[model samples]
Target chain A: MEWRWDFTIEILPRMLSAMLNTLLAAGIGYTIALVVGLIFLLGQRTKFRLCNWIVRECVEFIRSTPLIVQLFFVYFVAPQFGLVLSAWVSAMLTIGLHYGTYLSEVYRGGLEAIPRGQWEACRALNLSPARTYFRVLIPQALPASLPGMGNYLVGIFKDTPMLSTIGVVELMHTANALGAETYRYLEPYTMVGFMFLIISLPTAAWLRKFERYVGRSMGITK
Target chain B: MSTQNHPLELPEGSPLVRFSGVTKRYGDLTVLDNLDLDVGAHEMVSVIGPSGSGKTTVLRMLMTLEKIDEGVIYVDGKPLSHMERNGQLEFANEKYLRTQRTNIGMVFQQFNLFPHMTALENCIEAPINVLGMKRDEAEERALNLLDMVGMLEKKDQHPTRLSGGQQQRVAIARALAMRPKVMLLDEVTSALDPEVIGEVLNVIRALNSEHKLTMLMVTHQMGFAREISDRVCFFYEGKIAEQGTPDQIFNDPQNERTKQFLSAVLDAN
Candidate 1:
């Protein structure tokens, strides 16, 4: 119930080390999500109706359900089907997939924001589909996508605590262990909150600056 | 898709672009109905009509931006929307469209210059990326085109920073950088301010006289069209009501629709 500086100082090293795992998990998870989101977008864009339908429904299903339930299913249920995965792998896969659906929507919105005339211009100029998408469309989409993508970066970082449920031994897991061992929850939990606040605040500010920089570099904004 | 056993029968001394019985429908509305038209090499044809009269659709179809429900569009005397396979015509595939679309370029009403690029970059993008030209060559060609359009001073400016007319000039230069055999101008001046309209029209005039570029323009500028067009087409109800030399179409008009349209348009001025 009372604040304790001594205990906080005693647990600082373990907390800092655990924060590294948390950062690593978020970084790897976000990378996977970014790539997975593109694949999902492609799936929805493919010519095959069945494939589009299946990917669309999968995106919806994943999005409609809770992330913790999904984490449980991937961590607990897969082993039952003789597809056992380690805690780190299962946590990474679950986080990637859960957030990927959201990122795909972000990408779709970014793409749709482009004027139809741009595509027409590309076609009239006879640029190949690959060039149009990669060179023209993606650069334009990136500025539009950056804000949403940045939000999810923070979102995934906050969600790293969910990885603790699967025994990934990240920040939240360390906090819980320290609290149980010392029978003093206040310092450990408070330190965890401060740590998250410390990182998230600066990240959000930096992301805004980054978004503007991207827009300016692309000549989309003056 | 239309299956023709025989090869396309082009007219005598075939035109650079031929729209042969091309039909386009949007649900129940036929936007272009059984249309037949031609543009000879170095010819400038101006199409004028009220909105929904399918004037823009002509340019759109020639640019392969819209697919015809029936018939074929020939560019450089080859089918644009369809291909001949095994001596039979079938709907053209994407690969075929890519190869054939290189011969054409278009300037849009809204300019459609890539906002992410500067005027020079916009002009050079297609030449470098699509035509596989070396960067220096593409830049040189783009610089020359930007100069021709009177946008050389603003070549480093983005489309957003430029005025509407300047953006349009950049768009024109962008199209010409491809060195297209035919240029489609779909009301390219419609989006400009009244004062800026003259600058764009002046650019087009120079293009007509100096470059002699084969052009198909859909426009509302009756006077400008009358002055420069080698042939003027008056469209009504998805067909050309009348077409003739600018002198005949503007000064000694024939068709009732043409008379009504010209008078209504001229009266507004």
Candidate 2:
């Protein structure tokens, strides 16, 4: 199949417009993931053993299963149980929960990286547990968490293509429709790949700079 | 200062801090075995011992960082690890511990200054957050404490930027900012290099001579302990092998374990 300039130029506008849907899905999905990750992290940290175990196993089950399976289950299986969800809603929910488990582990690792001495210092200073966790521990954990958080940001963006399988009108879905209509896969698929590359590369770079900025601002670095 | 509000009646002339038959066990190994210790008001006591002799545990227990397996700790004449409920003692909850713990502050061997905060912020954080002091007032008191520790110039610098001795001085100042009635120094100088040890010890000496604060120190520096401590406790195998005025314990040393430990320690120097 020849790479045709005319065909590529013809489809550029549609692909670019579709990119907005992809960005929106990834952005909203990541926000949900961040909040859900905190909830999972709190569940794991709470004093209740049974709650911790249940949340932990749920996280593990979500993580171990395929993301596509989860997306299908939420979108296709829920309507049978009288809980109908739109493709966009199902995609966001599945993406949020699936990546949330990963992000919780990132948070757990970041928290564990803090030395035992810091907790003791908080205790000696008589800081309330809420103040200790929110003011002291979380800020310190952010620097350690930034890199893993950044990786997942890109991970979620790449994973948005999976939303196309559920008929979400995001970048990949639009590309697939264009290919089916035109009887040409080359232009749309290549454009989708280029669009993703263009966004992901700079995002990864920006995240690196952000991680350094957080570290320097927090005084973890000179 | 809230000591007056607690309803528990104190015995007349009772020490400010008392550890009555406190025992701490980690699995099968006993870190402190039926330990009885007391620190009178405005008194400075130094605990000296070999590694695993429970000297640091003495300070840790007083700070309520470790739960005692048996017996009770009293701070400001009220139970620290327990509460008076219906005229009987019950294990204190977090609320009770927080209120009672305000009277005591601890400085660790590792310094443990909040790395994200500057010297002044570290000192003021607990005061403003926990004690509900105004920011300006907390800053004023923290600056004074920084000045007292000779860390006034480094008030704006984070702990990573400061030397071990400087961080420790800041740690001491941070603890003192709370106006604690009793200060627990757990090998405060052990983490410093020999050259910087004097500077921290000098600040501690100033605290001993000039302030009326009660202090309990766990130290390996026999000479410095002898110079500043009103009483020196020699710990061995989770018990006080000997305790007396610094002169008596360091010079006349009656216990065989004390003599052996002292000789070994002095010979090293």
Q: Report how large a share of the reference interface contacts model 1 reproduces.
A: 0.86
Q: Lowest-lDDT window of 10 residues in candidate 1 chain B? A: B1-10
Docking class of 1: high
Model 2 regions more than 4 Å off: B1-9
Candidate 1, superposed: residue stretches over 4 Å from native: B1-6, B9-12
RMSD of 2: 3.0
Q: Across residues B1-269, which tens digit of lDDT does each residue of candidate 2 receive? A: 12233335458789999888788899999998988888999999999989999999888888888888877889878899778887777778888999999999999999998888889999999999999999999999999999999999999999989999999999999999999999999999988999999999999999989996799999999899999999999999999999999999998999999999999999999
- What i-RMS does each candidate reach, in Å? 0.9, 0.8
- Report residue B60 deviation for candidate 2 (angstroms): 1.1
Model 2 TM-score (2 dp): 0.97
